[model samples]
Target: MATDPIHQFQISRIVPIEVGSLDVSFTNSSLFMVATVAAVTLFLVLATRGRGLVPTRLQSMAEISYEFVANMLRDAAGTEGMRFFPLVFSLFMFVLFANLFGMFPYFFTVMSHLIVTFALAMLVIGTVVIYGFMRHGLKFLGLFVPHGVPGYLIPLVTVIEIISFLSRPISLSIRLFANMLAGHITLKVFAGFVVSLSALGAVGIGGAILPLAMTIALTALEFLVAFLQAYVFAVLTCMYLNDAIHPGH
Candidate 1:
């Protein structure tokens, strides 16, 4: 069969298992997800293992990663937001590593999957909602009602705000999932073109040059997109969490 670019996204069972009606089989996706977690855990642990007055390169990297997310949360939600540092940092690292790991050949990109991304998005918004209510009581509903609006406009504006708030999870998830999916698919298609063109003859060899160049260029761009998407996901989560912190705004 001709290689299908979309086939790269397929989930295959690695170890079949069943518990009653549930097919809780281990899959390629599951394996990569576990690997991603293990990789991140090891990176941070090893990088920071030797905390020193004069930092080693790995320690510097670990510190840089910590400060990056810490500053992001601080800027978005202020000092109080630091309380959620563990949550935000974990999300950022997981997504960032998953993205980078996916760029490797034959590795599954968990974030590219809608279910995975949507679940993550839901967790973010769910945390916001739960904490908002817990911290602010009924006042948390103020998030859907802006301050200083004319009485007549308040109803309309509040409805709009509620819709926007509700749409966060969907938009957040789709943004990450779609970006990763489209970027990878484009890379694969261009790569396949290079192979297909090179197979033809002398003319084919000449034709392959364009795709070969495009593929190389896109490889660099894809790496950027991978990091950028992860950053976007983390920043947006901070912003959303900020709303929960200060719903009056």
Candidate 2:
């Protein structure tokens, strides 16, 4: 074995099934996505099914999640944004679970891939643009043309603002993909050290202990990153939605 931990990024076909025009091959990446979605749905559905007032731990978690997102939207986008809470809550939970699920042994990290993250960013940015236009029509264009700037400098400022707005998807996707990919790769690298060194003999086995300890520490940090990344994604999304709602503000 070469012992290069980064080599695990390969996306393998679990089943090379082909359907005439569709060619619906199952892949490791797709498997993780399905698992993440299933995990999120099962947790939420099962957690809230009882609707208990005394509340078990699962129910408490579910209630906390609801209040967190609901309050976030209310605070950021005001009462009008409450209508979109279901979509936003689901989005946050899905991403949170997806990132958290990937931290396990032998699990495929879907969020580590740019295609997955980019697709998510596109959906968010697309909704912002579409809703902005629907709500404001041509007036939505005014979002890029900020107020308080002199008419003489408006063209220059408008171009800069437009460029920045266009960059949103790029930033959002790259931040998530890079963080997930880096965290997993780091853990893998440390683990490879533990395996390779322990195989060498007594002295090497002593060195292996340190790598094992490091792996545990890194694993815990990776879990924190999973939650942080999800929170960042949800908060940024709310902020962007806020702009669409209050264009000039």
**Candidate 1: where is the Cα deviation over 4 Å?**
none
- For model 2, what is the error of residue 9's alpha carbon versus the real structure, in angstroms, after optimal superposition? 2.3
TM agreement with the true structure for every prediction: 0.97, 0.93
Candidate 2: residue 200 Cα off by (Å):
3.1
Clashing pairs in 2: none
Local accuracy by lDDT, each model: 0.92, 0.88
- Supply the TM-score for candidate 2: 0.93
Alpha-carbon deviation at 169 in model 2, angstroms: 1.0
Each model's number of backbone clashes? 0, 0
lDDT of each residue in 20-71, candidate 2, tens digit only: 8887789988888888889888998899999998989999999999999999
Stretches off by above 4 angstroms in model 2 are: 17-23
